[model samples]
Target chain A: MLKAFASYMTYEFIGLDQGSRIGDVLNFFIYDTIKIFLLLTVIIHAVSIIRSYFPPEKTRKILAHKREFIGNILAALLGVVTPFCSCSAVPLFIGFVEAGVPLGVTFSFLISSPMVNEVAVVLLWGLFGWKIAAIYMVTGLLVAVLAGFVIGKLKLEKWVEEYVYQIKTGQGQQVLTQTFRQRLQYARWNTADILKRIWLYVVLAIGLGGFIHGYVPQDFLVRYAGNGNPFAVPMAVALGVPLYSNAAGVIPIVYALMEKGLNTGTVLAFMMAVTALSLPEMIILRKVLKIPLLIVFAGIMTVTITAVGYLFNAIL
Target chain B: MEIKVLGPGCANCHTMEQLAKTAVAALGIEARVEKISDIQEIMKYTMSTPGLVVNGKLKHAGKPLPSIEKVKAMIKEEA
Candidate 1:
């Protein structure tokens, strides 16, 4: 249906010539935009409902005081389902820390939370095939778990702000229990909220993708960031660090890069690097984590994300 | 009655505070609505941001701010 509409709009309504570049790009943009938005709405609403059950408090409870190996695994998985934003990072961090949750486990949650999400998954699946999307998710989780494990072993607790240890969160915290109807309401609002925030990014991304598909020559970036380039993955990760974007916003850009002959590993590395580490998020985290711990976290993330990019590039 | 809105001052936090103020006025209730942005004080109530505390008791926490009706209902419960 979407394909048919896109075709009709491009060929019949717009009256562009067959096989014309403008027609092709217009078709691509129209079809992908509508299709992706539809996918995003449905998936985001469902994910919101599912996420309602795993609030940060619950996620913390699930991992608190658990053993390290299993804890990192659970934290990574929970990070995907837990819906807390970076704004709540400090309290969430202090909450987890005060609850005796392992710092590494918390790191796993922090790493995976922003980088891997339903929106990113939906965007990837919509643009790329399911296999690529699956690969991205699995690798993201692995990086989160592994980096978190390494951080855990580093025993850098002292690097955290001293105030995080001394400040005791209030007990007898009241539970603002939601009814099923309330959950549904929350999901509806969440879907609207997410769409409002990212719709512009999605549209711009798809627009750029269409433009690239029509105008950009093939192998444009392959020479610089192709599989043959030994430094491509590291370089891509390095470029991605200062830039900030959520997974949804970056996937289309990644798609454009992938289309322009960038190696899969390099582009994917760039996407992860952009999402995983951002200047704003680092500053927000700085309130609780001292500069050294933040630096170490950033370093490990850069290395792990770069490795994942290289691994996938080599394999596929 | 005193009600506090706890958050680290994100966009949603402001909305939450607004919803709260509007709820109090619509109900015509004499309640002090306080905005709590201090991280240490916020953790004393809830781990999540944009938390709603009615009379120092947590009523709602986290995103997807409750409807004005719901806020009024919560305030009514405290009243």
Candidate 2:
């Protein structure tokens, strides 16, 4: 009797009982919140702690001191370790411009930072094999580096707000002093705050993912977006422009979509669209960059992500 | 120890913060963590909140939590 009662309670808490018609939706929302919470509290915190050592202001100085090509390369490398999120895009943009980093190089860093990260890499490795993950990383890095180089040659300096030109470079490094115990506390609190902010986005993304996971028609996707579909790659690229979110948020969806028969190229295109040209990130960028620069950036990203996606689909 | 996570409480920042705590707990370290939601305060640290500072030194920000061993090493080195 006791064991049976406990099992019943568990179902009730998870809302898995047969009588609960809302169980699926509620369960999904709860699952997402917890997943986002765990991700925020643990994965993101560790990354930030490491990031504290390599401040953006310092990165700008280092890159500025190097050759243009080297600067672009180093910037992409630094992007992997730095703490650039959707929210910080505008300020970082200002900081980069003020520090005299070329616009194209900065764009490369900006594009890569969100589209690829350790978390996404690890998650992708777990979901797919290492081959796909490796392909994703290499292709993503290439897109960012090449796009930035191309844009750099075009000289879109006029697109920047005049105020950005006046911003100073090399702000003094800010360091926090704390014992091991204290750093832990800082991490915990940040987790709570971050989870609160993006939990909804995570849930919505995951919920759509779950539905696709449970019920998307695979044959249709294969017929339309499979390796053989010539038009699928371009179509996927165009579609990525309007949808927005970072790589972290989109990778899971990619996994779910792939499980439902989505092709690698199509998934890659979606991931790029959502990562590099996120609507939310762009909206945030609007505060600093003009429409022309934003359009150009978006257009370039769309073409590159599409091409890469198709190329990977063909090769891998 | 003074720790500051800069952001308006986005998911990534939150995860980084949480993982920091988990690392601390697993390692048996006790500490105080502060969350900075205000844009002005965060701007004081390169406009990056969800940022981590150990002993008045900015150590990490922007990405998710790293491996526990690495974080433990960083804390010990700082000490």
Q: Which candidate tops TM-score? A: 1
Q: How does candidate 1 score on lDDT?
A: 0.88
Which ten-residue region of model 2 chain A has the weakest summed lDDT? A1-10
- Model 2 reproduces a share of the real contacts of 0.27
Clash numbers, per candidate: 0, 56
Q: Give one digit per residue, the lDDT tens place, for model 2 in A1-316.
A: 4434434444675547643534444454455445444554567678656665566777777776455666777778788877566777766777677667788888888888887776666555645657777877788888888888878888888887776776553455464455667556555554555555555555566666556644566665677666666887788777767777655567656866686677787787777777777777777777677899888888787778888887877776
Score candidate 1 by TM-score against the native: 0.95
The residue-by-residue lDDT of candidate 2 on B35-73, one tens digit each, is 766544555565554566555666665544445565656
**Each candidate's fnat, in order?**
0.71, 0.27
Could you tell me the lDDT of residue A124 within candidate 2?
59
* After superposition, candidate 2 runs with Cα above 4 Å error: A1-46, A169-217, B1-45, B49-79
Q: Residue A183 of model 1: what lDDT? A: 84
Task: Write down the C-alpha DockQ for each prediction.
Answer: 0.67, 0.16
Tens digit per residue, CA lDDT, model 1, A190-244: 9998888888888888898889878988888887777678999899999999889
